[model samples]
Target: MGGDPISLNQDADLHLYMDGEMEPARRAAFEAQLASNPALAAKLDEYRHQQDMLRLGLDMMAAVSVKETETLAGRLRWRLDMDRFSRRVAPLAAAMLLVMGGWSLTVWVQSGAGTGPQLAGEVDDVPAFADEAAEAHSKAIALNTLQPSPPQVEAAPVPMQTAQVPLPEGHVMTVTLPAIGPELTLIRASIVPWNHGTALQFLYREPDGELLTLFVASGGPAQDGTLHTVVQDSLRLVYWRAGLVAYTVTGNKADGDLLTVAKKMADSIRRS
Candidate 1:
């Protein structure tokens, strides 16, 4: 073995020799030089050891990178599935909330807490034409168009003030004359224009000279035989339905008194 190191060009060839890229003749010559030059041989051993360490480090990094990529892909897939599930469920949850809210609102309205009209019976609401009836009464009174009744007339079907205005065809309603107490005199009876159909308006005079109006229409709901009352324009109005005929009695009287008169009138029409 020589004590001196190899030349620079021969040292550069060491890697080619170690990697077996050198020609066979050159590889044999380099091996003989390594056997004789101890320093060159030691240097080749060090380069080989460094290459092995670098290869081991690169393998470890590649394994860690692959594992991390798999974990990241799994988390992304889980998140996508959760997002899809939420999208499918969102509309159903919104619909349930809307239905529940509507139900609660209906309950509040029916419980008499809302601003809608209150009823004394199991009926849903006041007659739809109640406000119209009240307005007609006021207009008639303001115009002083009501006639005075003949003194001491009994409760009977009064003569029509104008030509008979019949309900529109296809309406199943029976126009029955209301038989109220003798204390209420029929002052005027006429057919008036109504929204759903023609309506019968009857003007009556109470014992105290207070005027009362009874409006009859064909647009009532199914007869629940319940009396409902509401106040409009400072007038107490009592209303009910019998079969297809609906009746509203309005007067500047106490609620109980007006309701009593309405019930009697409704009963008379039902019997007729």
Candidate 2:
């Protein structure tokens, strides 16, 4: 205030003076100087005004920055929500497509398109025949091994060959006989009749040009031996019980010949 502009140190003291903390003598000296320096008085007024404006501008800038931060946070939240929504729908959309594809495949299969029925029919037919054959073979074994009891007869030597026998329902089964020789061919056969359970038949041929037939019924063995003796015309028949099974050998040849074949076959089976 006295010469050029007051030093910063002196200006600081002036602020303290304005707050009324200055000593009485110093205050009186500052007042005398201020009266002589009009330019310093104007500068002090301007400094006060600038400080007030700076504080107001800082308050406005702080409020604006907070508003912008809030707006940015809201936009980020909205984007996150949209992303979550899309993620949740993605699996649902994929599942819908898979379900649609499966339904189409099922429809195509059930409609019998693309050889489905023909393939199924062929598959079913093969198993049916196999089941029937298996069933027949099982029935024959059951008839021979279970039910009526039989006494095993002794073995005898004889010639052998293969033969086929006709049955009901157009079913024909082959048989091997002489019940002897390793080359003999036997076609296992079975028949089921009402009230009779099952009957197993084994057809065989002797080297002497004689045809032989073997029959086994599922029931107790005969006590009277009537079935063994009863035969039509010149056909010779012999029957015996082996374990729980009944065996009967019939042939147009001699009874000794039929018995010989039956014994050989039974021996072979037992050995096997």
Candidate 3:
């Protein structure tokens, strides 16, 4: 409300709407536009994803009522740790059985006969963070750093790098990486510069042989401030903000796993 609203089109506008900062009439107008626009509806779905996940994380982590709790970090961390272990094993155990049996299959595949239905002239309503993360992930695969690019570059791997200096944006801020699980270990911490600002992309090696990157950008908290996943070609990213930072954990089709990590990270941060 303090800054001049820009036709209410910016990310902060999403914040304002979710934050209930708009007047009743303005909010109704925005809702009208949203209802009539499928693209806008899809975008709001992304924001809502985050909001729901964050709320779930809080509920899972909250011990006593907020009014009753003091020094509750330990309780929250224990629950998060338990949740983390439960998620990690369920998948690996299933996959390991396949590997042992020499079984392999893909769940989905797109044909190259120009049969896919992408808009020829239609525009995407997805947020910039999703686009940025997807592009970088594709490139990371193209470079063949960790694995071979999927034929679909048909795909490859990401080369890992660490950054110990400020990014070009002149300001550097990052959230704590998810508390590492035994099944995954940190691999790379690199500066990923996006259109709005620089995001610190922390890469991790998972047991599945695929890679994970967590992008953290500072100072642009969405008003809704929730955890949501944006699913797209070549990648999936779960985004949310806490305190001064907005964070996303992206991967090469790790939509479900990413959200699990996101919720754990969110819970971990909220614990303190």
Candidate 4:
């Protein structure tokens, strides 16, 4: 009786007499309100220690339910008799391997003239093809580059120009070219300055005015006598080559309107 005691219908008749499903006059009025309540007799001893730990975990799952139903009926009778035990052991394992290969060829023809049975030295375990044939003969002697020099000196830097400004109408831009060729329609004056053979810096403007960049190089204008170039500082740079990929488009916009928008986007991709 903690001062003004029970009465939400006597705490739903003490939870239906602690759930033994009530009725003996509502379990004698919930054992006379748990003998006049010391906090309802500590909530009926914590609901009888949670109904005796749920009947000792359902009597340990009813003692392993008959040894898990006889190990699931012996794995469903060994998957319904595996094809009559592989048709009774495949012809007695091929007549015991043809009677042990005819008694090992009649004891190697009665131990012949130059004797037999001297084998014990097998250490191969399979891994030394001479270190993979000496790593494929040191990768064929480092790809055979036998002394022949002086033909690869490309380092001519001094080209920078790019500009393409014109997207203001509805302003939406996202260009990622260099997957080389065909999908080209990037207007707003075709922009450029993506210098190959180096001296780079492409574009920038994202103080939330959104415009950022990148245009790198390592040989373009398909090499021989190389000539694909464009540069613009303040923003703009475009360089081009289409098949084996080479493209550049920087931004900050000025070198003579980014080299006249990189020569009208390289003459509109060499006239389509």
Candidate 5:
């Protein structure tokens, strides 16, 4: 109550946020601040007023079976307006608000909206985004390199000459592969299907002929800060979460080199 006017204003904003009426950018900004602002976060928690939006949304879509429901990968690309996060942000980000009743409501433009039981609280069950990226990177490389004589599908041929490739929902993405730079070079960019959902993949060729794969999805094991580093076998991945999109940069390069490019890519996306 020290600054009665400002405190009252924030209180009203909190109410609006819980009502699912807060603008997407503003809501994410507030959540990001909560991670570093313990006092503000604690105050919000004391008045934890639950909302019924997700519940209502679920009953309306209950007829949809689990197969038609949104998977973790699908939820990643869903619009930010339909989701919310815990104000008690920590080293590991978990879901709190958007999840309601018992299931997490996922709304995607491509796939009709529905709910799923794979809620975010059980931290151990949540797949590590970095590890996922490394696996995706290795898979993409193996598919392209190891299977050199891939049987040609007589489908429409893909054009090979484009400076800045765009994904299907390119407008909705936060990260875009940049032009060749000191840190890295962009070779190709496209959207690929993963886990029955779409992922924005950017392939970059290192000076040493190693290919670096960057995967951008709507959500994953994301914490707001420097890119996290994870190594598995011969692959290394650096990844982070931003707003609705989680970005992972993976490669076979040395740790330092991989990290440098990862940070550069993350910074560019943030700046744009």
Candidate 6:
């Protein structure tokens, strides 16, 4: 009776929604309320802005790795009370800005600010996965080289054209091995297990005798078809996601067209 009952109830519901704790039916109901209540919708937008700022500030500070930032951001999202989010984030974000230096911070925030959630954190999602893919490619190649080549027979041929790899939870992904050019041959397709999940690795031999591996996994943080590239040492990784699956093309740094190959793979997956 003392406060607006609708605002008080919805403020808590909004927090649950943002924290990803709301039940599906309840979430649907809350979203329907957003359609009818302009004030509630505005409040939702304000909270989202604050959430994005907190994530971006933590990312820009240079003290947190992407994985650690995601964990801390999750806790921050849960604890950001409706009335106190701005107060709690303002001082920390300001200090992060100072630590990052003014000109660079200004450019980064300007580029990503108010562009919705994907652009807010997409830049911070690629490095860890890219490193893993590169490592997997290296290890797979080393193992393959240690094996003895099977005898070639006139009547028998090995099947390297396509492979169906099994995944967790009874899932399966079809990998169409590509022979891109005369010297680029699809060598092997296999499963590599890691922290996130099992990835289907399609290994190929390049024209320069270098190995290229395309890693496909079922899920990734950014699935909006944005290509992210990272280079470490001698390897370059071009990553993108379409629908429910993600793709990464890993090759030598000298191979300047890996991004083009990744884009073509993404287009093929989307079309299929």
Top candidate on TM-score is: 1
What is the C-alpha lDDT profile of model 5 across 1-272, one tens digit per residue? 22223366666777777668899989988776566566666666655622256566777887565632345335445523233332235213324334443223223311222221111111222235455667777677756653453342333322222223233555443444433464344556677666624677777666576788877776444455445565566555666675556777777665656665666556655554
lDDT of 5: 0.55
- Clash totals, every prediction: 0, 6, 20, 26, 2, 0
Predicted model with the maximum lDDT = 1
User: Would you give me the overall lDDT of model 3?
Assistant: 0.58
- Full candidate order by lDDT, most accurate first: 1, 6, 3, 5, 2, 4
Please list the C-alpha lDDT of all candidates, in the order they appear: 0.70, 0.49, 0.58, 0.40, 0.55, 0.64
**On residues 79-182, what C-alpha lDDT tens digit does candidate 6 reach at each position?**
45632876778688778868878556355433533222222222434555566788888777656555643442232222334456566788776655333444
Error of 4 at 213 (Å): 79
What tens digits encode model 4's per-residue C-alpha lDDT throughout 113-196? 122112112122312221222233222222222323224323333123332322335433332232222222211121332212
Model 5 ranges off by over 4 Å: 1-129, 147-183, 220-223
Query: How many angstroms is residue 87 displaced in model 6 relative to the true structure, after the best TM-score fit?
Result: 52
Span of 10 residues, lowest total lDDT, candidate 5: 115-124
What is the TM-score of each predicted model, taking all chains together?
0.47, 0.29, 0.44, 0.16, 0.41, 0.44
Off by over 4 Å in 6: 1-128, 144-167, 171-183, 253-255
* C-alpha RMSD for every candidate: 33.7, 42.7, 24.0, 30.8, 22.6, 19.7
After the best TM-score superposition of candidate 1, give how far the Cα of residue 243 lies from its true spot, in angstroms.
Answer: 0.4
Superior by lDDT: candidate 1 or candidate 2: 1
Using TM-score as the yardstick, the better of models 1 and 2 is 1
Tens digits of per-residue lDDT for model 2 on 86-105?
78996897688687775564
Q: Model 6 scores what on Cα lDDT?
A: 0.64
- lDDT at 213 for candidate 1? 93
RMSD of 3: 24.0
